[model samples]
Target: MDLRLAVYHAAREGKLRLLQKLLGGRSAAERGEATSGAGAGVGPPLLIAARHGHRAVVDYLLEQCGARVGEGGPVSFDGETIEGAPPLWAASAAGHLPVVRTLLEHGACVNQTTRTNSTPLRAACFDGHLDVVRYLVGECGADLEVANRHGHTCLMIACYKGHADIARYLLARGADVGRRSLKGNTALHDCAESGSLEILKLLLDAQARMEKDGYGMTPLLAASVTGHTNIVEYLVEGALQQEEDEEEDEPAAEGKKDPSTAGLSSSSSSGQPQVYCTREAAVEALELLGATFVDKKRDLLGALKHWRRAMALRHQGGHDLAKPEPQQLVLAYDYSREVSSMEELDSLVTDPDEMRMQALLIRERILGPSHPDTSYYIRYRGAVYADSGNFERCINLWKYALEMQQGNLEPLSPMTASSFLSFAELFSYVLQDRSKGTLATQLGFSDLMGVLGKGVREVERALLHRKDPIADSVQFTKALAIILHLVFLLEKVECSPEQEHLKRQTIYRLLKCNPRGKNGFTPLHMAVDKETTTVGRYPVGKFPSLHVVNLLLECGADPDSRDYDNNTPLHVAARNNCPLVMSALMEAGAHMDATNAFKQTAYELLDEKFLPKAMMQPFNYVTLQCLAARALDRHKIPYKGFIPEELEAFIELH
Candidate 1:
């Protein structure tokens, strides 16, 4: 082994004497060679010991071997380690307070950063090392506002890792709550993505703005997309409360009028209701407030009052009089779509409908009904209606939009593709809920099949018309996978020979399309791409359609195919905590022992600390245990109670 490797091993293993012997009597040139391995370079012995929390080895390396405490060096031979990090950074990253103190006492810079501009304070915060973070900010005078290469502040990293205590300490120490990442996400956004409800509340109380990120996603929408139900509820409640508070303050600022002298008639001077001009506005207000009563009964009466006031403004032409510019109208429409998606997840229907209607009206007026932009808004409105359980209306709206673009747009246009996808998704939903008197039930199976077949042919024609259709395009592959997945779902129902032929053609197209798309994800990966949530397990039998996975498997997709990160389908399933997918992959003999590029087994990657919050879940703990049991069984190892008793009972019972 290289001398640096030998020294690194000795220090990491806490063999101080061995580390000293390796360094003693070595020439300066040899010492440099030992510290500098091939490529980046293995970190010095002191850094190795500090990173492993070997206090004695670190002390001996510094005090006895005369290792320079502040000396910066290249990365380790593994090529995965950080380059140009000082000993203090390693110690801080590992949460070795003693080693950190020793290095600092020996004149190490407290704020020294890595080549990525990641400071020791950020490392400590990222690891949830509260004591070390406090020491760095409070005693060592580390800059709280410093951001890493990704522009993540200590507070943001703390929230991102779900370290509530560290976040609190950092906030108390004056860490800026408004500091944003390179993506323009604040600490609150990090908390939302991480499902750190406690940290989210802390940031909210500290006045973190509920602003949109570069992707036009609010913190609430981010939480919803990640399926953090608790965070979603909290954010919604907070928004309602802020609106209430603002309403209350408005009267105070305007000075209260004498209610006794005010007109008490049902009609205003203009012969309209005092609160609203149109009956539609009144009905909408009641519906919006009434929808909340199902789950948010506590806010019902207050919300009703607030709605009346809002409607009064709208009735007085609040929307038309202060019409936003065309650009602002588009932005408003985008925000409405995000809110509509969140409401769909929450099963709340009223607010999204009202928002969508407002956006659609604005777009129709500004862009004209036949404009492609108006058609896009129409498609969005259809989605909102579908989410609201009005499948027939959703289908009609989408069909109208498609009709408007039939001659004006190219078959291969992105807008046309999106419309087809919308129809496919809505039709699939209708099929799934056929017993619920959905639109598909009204239309016979043959009629639905006709619509689906037409869509398939249009998509196929578009794909074939493209020059060099086989050329790799991530967007095309994703679109093709979605269409095929829908076709696979339709395959479960009985079909005529023509419909069956179309289905087979769709499947052939998907199979022929390049599976290796963006981030090296195969079509199978895109089919089940929902992020895992910390909230709870998805209800039984509600997993996204398994037909996609089944079709891919039957078509000879390698179960152990690795992505760019070398994560196989099993690894993806494990990280996403999709137990149903996990079962299917395991049944198909997926490689349970397959490891990622980081040498993490599928079981080991089960949404612990490293993955984004959206990918962490309490249910993943159970999945981890189950996967562990499966691994042991595969190896013919005995069940020796290595797992928790409850888990063992679950495995045995199942």
Candidate 2:
């Protein structure tokens, strides 16, 4: 080992005598020899000692053995350094306070950097080593202003990790509290991410910036995601109070004697304070600031009220807001509406607000609810409410918009069926309130089944009975397939064996019509569509038959059936990496070599990236077989079959 590395090792391992002996034996100037793991045979021993936390060894080499400190560069045990952090940086990161102190004391440069362009202080701070940081910054006077490769300072790193004391000490010692990272994140950003109220208040007291990040996120926005409501309030309150103080200072300044005017014969200082900043402007600025904080949080209700009042002031001052950005309009609606309940038929109606008692009042005040021009408004509002814990309400409103096929469609009309399907799909997914069991029960699955069944029979009868075969009848057939899928999903939950059998038969019958049959599914696709039931309580399994996919293929349901995307059933199965489906598709004559629009083969689309070795066992077999088959079939090569003699004999006898 190099002399410096040996000294570093002795120091890290607490080998006081060894460190002392090495230091004393070597002349001070002689010990400063720089050795690299590069051109030379071996690296300096001090690098090893420091890398292993041997503080005593490090002290002996530097102080007694006379080892010299040099500039840090790429030096890795495993050969993967980014910029140039050496052994000392490693020691600091591992919380070897003693080693850190000894290095700094013995002239290991405080601001020394490595291949990654990271300083020792940055390494300590990033790893949450407060003691090492204190020793470097307080005792040795390391530059607290130095930033890492990513432009993050010790204070920013400290705040990000919720190290309140380190942040306080750094701030007291003149660290830039408002310094932003490469991404424009300051100490406030770090503190907000930590969700630590104490750290956030410390940064705020130091006047750390509350400005937006590169993506326009403020401290408050970070706090919201972490669910730190208190931290969010603290930052907002500080900004608000600061604005108030500025308001008071403006008036006092106006009352002070004016030097320029006093020199002129006709000029005199005002005895009373003249109004420079108005009460309205002060209120408005504070309101707008509050609105900004809330808006960053996407707290729709709070923001809407604040912005509305602020906008009122703007209008009074004869100002107009730039056309609200699409995103802002989205936020405005998010704060404004509520959903109530979902109808059995899937039609959604908005929850009436008592705040607007009359229709005309509602139309004038609130953006006309459910109006075509304002659909997105209601949709966004409903979405925000869903995100804010009012799930039932969100579900109701979403259904209303998605299901409006006819203005006055009856319970079982074609329009009603269309509306029901739209509503069913939306509610089945979105509302999902377990508390609505009573309402779901009242709606009755049997009624839905009857309507769906009637529709299915109507289509089948038309297909079998009609001579001209009106092209429009395809709509009824598609509706019936959708209904069968819904029924198939429901049967898995509470339906009897007979109902299940009926559902299976309906699926089979629907498959015979084969709406998108050529791409890989018939009515039997429900066996695989993993959507939830109407009540949303149970997870309906993919298809019932282990052999259902095989049966579909045998019965002429296309193995390559795709929806609008032209993706074969084999494609969906492969993308999900479902081995059974893949096998069935291959056995059923799906072209293994087919590529999607992305020009990716079914095998290539399987995401094996970063998967654990153990969990990958299944995918391994499936991918290999699929790819092997594709290669063989492409060249007209036949694959040999594998079957037991007993199975072969049984098949021959049958």
Candidate 3:
């Protein structure tokens, strides 16, 4: 066995004599030399012993052999292993309290983090190792407030893993109850997500705030989404109690206040309202928990009123109050409108656009003009405009929104990617109808081209400057594909040198990335597939485009690139009865007789019967067959199954 494995096994099996022989027999200098010479596999023998609860081996390794206790253990990176770790973390994770105590007594770093930034306290808390957790914090002085790589504290992990006792102990030891993760999720949110009613109660008792996360998900909403009925019920009860307390306190405070003084006091001067679950969120939670509403309309109207008040209170303290986060507000609006529409309640005010606009303005004021939230709301409003048949307003809104987004967000950020997709969709819609002359007349060609040119430049910059272009190559390729299609549509115009350069660069980037789309087809395959279709026309099936195929070929796309089915671009074009594409491929020197997994060649797969009736008028199957026959002849290949007479008969029938 390898020296590392031998030492590991000796420790794991509690062979104290063998472990001693491996290291304890050596002097301090010799032991150090032995450990130093051991490869990455030989992690600190102390960690191995501690992990398997070999207390005797751990003591021998640390006390006699003088093994370092603070060294980190093995970490896997891209299928290769690198060993290192603080032995206390491994011991605490394994719930070996004796090993943990022994290591700490020997001066192991109690709060030392592993490769993943996880401390011994976090490991113990995650595993619900009560004794180990207690010893780490109580005896070894482990930091309870430290968070791991994902910003999860001991309390959050305990709640997430449903370790109620561990969570209680952490709270008792003064863990921060209101601490949030990078995504703003609290311990209560974890408890709700885990469906642990006991942990949920513990967190609530510890005064865990019920604020929304960055995604506008509160604990109640999280519980509802996960279908946790009991937890949802508990949260709802807590919310109701909070509301009742506020109501009871309201009248007494009102009675004590002077009417003359009240006139001068602004709303901001009043005490901040306690953060609780919004009524809309609570009702939605209850409904999702399988609770039926008897008076649905009344409940919805009441929820709407409650949300409006919450929104007002959120912005009451000027800049002191929390900024407007629209997800929850949008949810409220959606629910209100949905319920009203379902019950046909005409009496309810149904102006969602105005409400959304108000929310957007408040978010911009609070979160600033270039915040991702602001951009998101802008995109949402632009989509609303698009849906209302106001294309001009929609395009203008997206243009300004993209400009704002470009200022703050990186080009490859999800926010910018989403905006790009939406912009591309709207642009495609306009191009689809440009040949009809209505869109061209409404927006002058120069203005339209200018917008398109700007979009192309943005996409190019994003693709070129992306941190990991290959990982995000699919999205980049799709964006470039859209740009190329737009460029094709503008072929009639006298293009600027810059526009022509962008078109060429865009095609080159698309080919260089060689992005395999979700369907497993490369950009080359997609280009050919798109070209098979008629220009300015939606094909009922596969319509061939010679223009796109020629463009991709010029950009050095593999003419014979295969898709998921191992069908080359020629096979696809031939299977779809695309005569023009077949000709283009043959001219590009595509393998004429390349066979797919099914052993069917491109020429053998052609079937005129599969052609749509509308397409049969313009397409000549006999001509396509003749082209295939000529290519076969040039290659000195004979027709296998069909005789000369049969070929003539088939051509005559076509």
Q: Which prediction has the highest TM-score against the true structure?
A: 3
Decide which is better by TM-score, 1 or 2. 1
Off by over 4 Å in 3: 21-28, 35-38, 75-84, 238-275, 284-461, 464-553, 556-654
Model 1 stretches astray by more than 4 angstroms: 38-41, 64-84, 238-654
Question: How high is each candidate's TM-score?
Answer: 0.43, 0.38, 0.50
TM-score of model 2 (CA atoms): 0.38
**Local distance difference test scores for all models:** 0.61, 0.52, 0.62
Ranking by TM-score: 3, 1, 2
> Where's the lowest-lDDT run of ten residues in candidate 3?
259-268
**Residue lDDT tens for model 3, 75-189:** 3333655345577887888789988888888888888987667888998898889999988888777899899878899999999899999999999999999999998999888
Alpha-carbon deviation at 366 in model 3, angstroms: 20
Predicted candidate 2 versus true structure: per-residue lDDT over 1-654, tens digit per residue: 756566545554667786556655555455555323343333455665676777656655555544445534444544654345565686787788877766766667888876556778887887778888888887787888888778888898889888888888888888888788888888887887888889876776786656766645566655643546566555434333333344465454545433111111211235432221233332333333333333244443554444344444333322232222222222223333321111211221133232111111222122223233233333444565556756555555544433432222232345445444543454344324435653433333454455455545545644554443344435443454456445543532456778656656655665666543223234444344332122223332234333555545544666555554555555566555565666666666665555655555556555565322244233433455456545654576543455566543322211
CA error at residue 268 for candidate 2, angstroms: 23
